[model samples]
Target: MIENDCSDLFVQNFSFWKHLTDTEKQFLCDNTAPVHYFKGTNVHNGNSDCIGVLLIKSGQLRTYMLSEDGRDITLYRLFGGDVCILSASCVLDAITFDVFIDAEEDTDVLLINSAAFRQLADQNIYVKCFGYQLTAARFSDVMWAMQQILFMGADKRLAIFLSDEISKSGSNEIKMTHEQIARYMGSAREVVSRMLKYFSEEGIVELYRGGIRIIDKKKLHSLI
Candidate 1:
């Protein structure tokens, strides 16, 4: 029960909130609490007690797991409009997977209680539909990530990831360290660094202090 003033954030994503009925929106506004976390903070630890859904309002979070050998395998990066599943599953089944979430940047989240969610879904058809859609989208993304890990080569996978990030941010320049890239790529940081260096030598990209800037989009696309 962290608390913050959410008056500004409440209307920031009108479309997402507008999907719910007037009453439903009011119910959430009344019950949901706003919480803020600084960068590198843990939102929730793996296998922790189930809570309610966390609706991201701003910033980014990386959900990941640590391997036995002390490596991080990133699952996904959750941003604004994205809902964390731990809260949803806790409300529905009182159980959830062991997943760790860390704030990639300072983040704001709307903490909706399980009881409030259940009540809203029980009364609002649109809310139920929205929930279903979100679940489906999450499943699809997981499937796609799994497919890439199993079937794609490391270089191709890196290229695809970079391409997607560039498209999402609408810029060829991406702000991510080699360690971050390694987590997402499910490879060693040293390996990722070597690959990036190779790409740089090939004039495929330019490495910066805290990021990589794609210089030759056509050639990078050809790699994938």
Candidate 2:
């Protein structure tokens, strides 16, 4: 029988699981396992690792890529309850780009074996639909990120990022180093520092040794 221990959390996001037969459910449970990651851990590298689907049960994860010179840019992020299929690159022939997965906070993940998942998909219509939907969702996220980089000005993008962070934390100040900000924005630390200095002079933000405080959301919005 399929283990029911984590079914509540698992089913909350994968409701189609309820449609499976006992044998199918048991098969999945047998091939699946739970994994935990501490904040800042690299869950998957864009290397030779056989990627598999991950369902986040708690905390957050980031999907990003490294550039030729080693700078990084975030592609998309997955929060609790999000399903990740791009990580299952072996079964999906269309995934041409490389990305890395990392935990943004302490996290819980349910790992499904890629080969097993492909087998299930081949046998179950619901599983096929779920897989297709997941692929479409992740592709949309990637396209959105590409648009943000190609069309949005760097200052505007940074301002929007800071504004969103401030709103998320319900505080004007956020803890982040220039290096961290540079990694997210896919720029150099010096470039990020210079931009922050410009924003400070413009009365949009204040920078300290370890973090930044937004001073004017209106001005930041105006930049965009």
Candidate 3:
């Protein structure tokens, strides 16, 4: 049986876990431990030794890569219910890459040791399937983001980001700054500010001191 604490944290939103047999849940519960990190803390850094997988329980996290010249490329954002396979390449091929992870906000996660996770994947069909699904989804998202950067201009990308935020929060008022948006879009803050000004002029969105309010969702979608 899954422990109440484990069920409450890692397995709550993991639908694939429901397909696992009782013995599988028991095995995982025995092997995993919960961890917490405060905002602005490094969960893991680029070039660190490969250790384990992380399943987010609450709050936000960011994965980024730093260039030799010291530029950050926002790689992926993790929210509640998301799982990050921190070192898949190293785990499989015995090599590592420069990929850093940090808590975007105060966060909680369940850390499943690599050996136990591998054993579970080997023995549990549901675990294998879940792994495949998560990998495929991550790959697809990266590809889509790359395609947007190649074919779409900064204005369109920023507009789409605002619209997405509106949809996510169920309100036009999004509680993030232009700098944060620029980080997510992999562009300059000045570029985002200029685009927002253009958007405001075009009646697509309204900029406030602390947040942005979407004025025309349909127009933003059309630009995207």
- Per-residue lDDT tens digits for candidate 3, residues 120-174, read 7777767666666776676677677777667889887887778777886698798
**TM-score of candidate 2 to 2 decimals:** 0.90
TM-scores of all candidate predictions against the true structure: 0.77, 0.90, 0.80
Off by over 4 Å in 2: none
User: What Cα-based lDDT does every candidate model obtain?
Assistant: 0.76, 0.83, 0.77
Residue 60 C-alpha lDDT in model 3: 86
Worst 10 residues of 1 by lDDT: 1-10
lDDT of 1 at 27: 75
The candidates, ranked best first by lDDT, are: 2, 3, 1
Higher-scoring candidate on lDDT, 2 or 3: 2
Candidate 3: list runs displaced more than 4 Å.
7-25, 87-89, 94-98, 119-133
Best by TM-score: 2
Candidate 2 positional error at 118, Å:
1.8
For model 3, what is the error of residue 147's alpha carbon versus the real structure, in angstroms, after optimal superposition?
Answer: 1.2
| Sort by TM-score, top down from the best | 2, 3, 1
lDDT of 1 at 41: 92
lDDT of 1 by residue, 26-134 (tens): 6787888888989999877766655567889889988777776778777677898777765465554323456678888899988877788777767766666656666
